[model samples]
Target: MSNTFPPVDGTWRNHYLLMRHGHSQANQEGRIISSPALGLTGFGLSPRGCTQLDTLLADWRWARPQRILHSDFLRTAETAERVAAHFDLTLTLEPRLRERHFGEFEGQSDDRYAEVWARDAKDPTHRQGGVEAVSEVAARMRAVIDELERHYHDETILLVSHGDPLQILLTALEGRELSLHREREPLAPASITSL
Candidate 1:
């Protein structure tokens, strides 16, 4: 957070394009699918999701990426594949980019997210009901950027991940308290946030 990342090549010149995966079956069904097991096999892109990606790529307005990294979850993987194929870049599967684990809430209605967030608002590190701690997610997300900066410079890199993980990462990058994560604007499916 707060640009604390060590300078790379004498400056933080790299740009990271943070992309949320397009709407998935979970989005269509209004369910939460955060488990890596469930995400890997089910909850892939919905038909609308495919169209969203197609439209986005047809008129992409952001910096073209030199490298693509994405969570191994099916939805994110498919999203990254679409972009990578269009840009003629290889894809790297990064588990650290996986969605936040919702534990007992997996496959539940999306509304249940409110309950977790309510608790998160009070304690960012809470892991009740087996949920992953918010701080841990922030750390792994930060680690991805740290790793990228250490190896690359002056390049645009794309990272495809789920909504919550990306949001948490952004909040951390902004130097905001994790408890305030829910206060940020919700990320639209297939939307991009650059850093």
Candidate 2:
């Protein structure tokens, strides 16, 4: 298929479809599960999440993904599996696309994310509450995009990941400050944003 998406002015050689994984067990329980310890084995997609993906795929309107890369976390893994299987495409695990490590905030109330953003707004490199630095998340997310751009030109690739990391990536892609990540629109569960 011809690439209808416009190329970046001086970079980004591939079309990108960034998608947040479906609602997870953590989302259902209103908890923040951002660490590998909890995310790897637990907080997978909920029943509603499955339904959401089924419905989304049934009436999909966006560019079809020729390749799928996703976080290894159970939630994103499940999401990518469904998408890849539906499209008969190979699924690749990209660990750098994992959720922002919440550190001390793992398994806590989701509301605690506000505090993390507050600190992030002041200093993107701050690791208060042992949280992963916003700058670090941005760097990894950017690296994934750069690598994908270099490897896959003139194709639509889907990246399944978490909300926070996706937001930081989007902000960075827009040439904005990492500290302003929260200022970008929030990525709803299973929502897709293109670049």
Candidate 3:
């Protein structure tokens, strides 16, 4: 809720829950979609996605959350809404948790999506105008978490977002090398992981 930057390695009084958005059109068609793009509205939670959400909530074994934060992207927003409703919490949109900007790659073929990421793997800092550089995405994700820390220091925050940005954030926390950025695997829809 607070926009201020948190101290580096702030108090770990609260648990941060990271979850990937449910099944989406882009995901089904293997396209690299951005958060602001069309076709993402309500197209986020497919029938199977809804099933996954039900299963996840029914089987949730993670820590109980105090607040829910997620990207405005349809899939994430929808997913967060479902989970929040299950927990009787409000869904809050946080743009920093949005999907990576695919740049020239939005709503394209699968092969093309692969090509851009391959290039990004070779040079993580290259900004191809439309696409967000890995470094930039990672930095903003850190900013989002840090800001949460400063404001919700002792409050558990549930963050629902896309795959790439989530991977970037986890990699940053693990202190892994940047060159292995693209190698991070995707997170399952409705799956919850702690940070």
What would the per-residue lDDT of candidate 1 be over residues 1-195, giving only the tens digit for each residue? 112223323456688888999989999999999997899878899999999999999989888999999998999999999999999999999999999999899889999999999999999999999899899999999899888888998999999998899889888887789999889888999998867
Q: Name every residue pair that clashes in candidate 1.
A: none
The candidate that achieves the highest lDDT relative to the unseen native structure: 1
What lDDT tens digits, residue by residue, belong to model 3 across residues 1-195? 111122345546567888888777666777666738563564577777888888888988777899998988888888998888988998788988888888777777656757767777788888775688888888999888777776875777889988788877777776775546667665777767786
Each prediction's whole-model lDDT (CA): 0.89, 0.88, 0.76
Number of clashes recorded per candidate: 0, 0, 2
Task: Give the lDDT ranking, best first.
Answer: 1, 2, 3
Q: TM-scores of the models, in the given order?
A: 0.94, 0.94, 0.88
Name the 10 consecutive residues with the lowest summed lDDT in model 1. Answer: 1-10
RMSD of 3: 4.5
Model 1 TM-score, 2 decimals: 0.94
Model 2 residue pairs with clashes:
none
Candidate 1 Cα misplacement greater than 4 A, ranges: 1-11
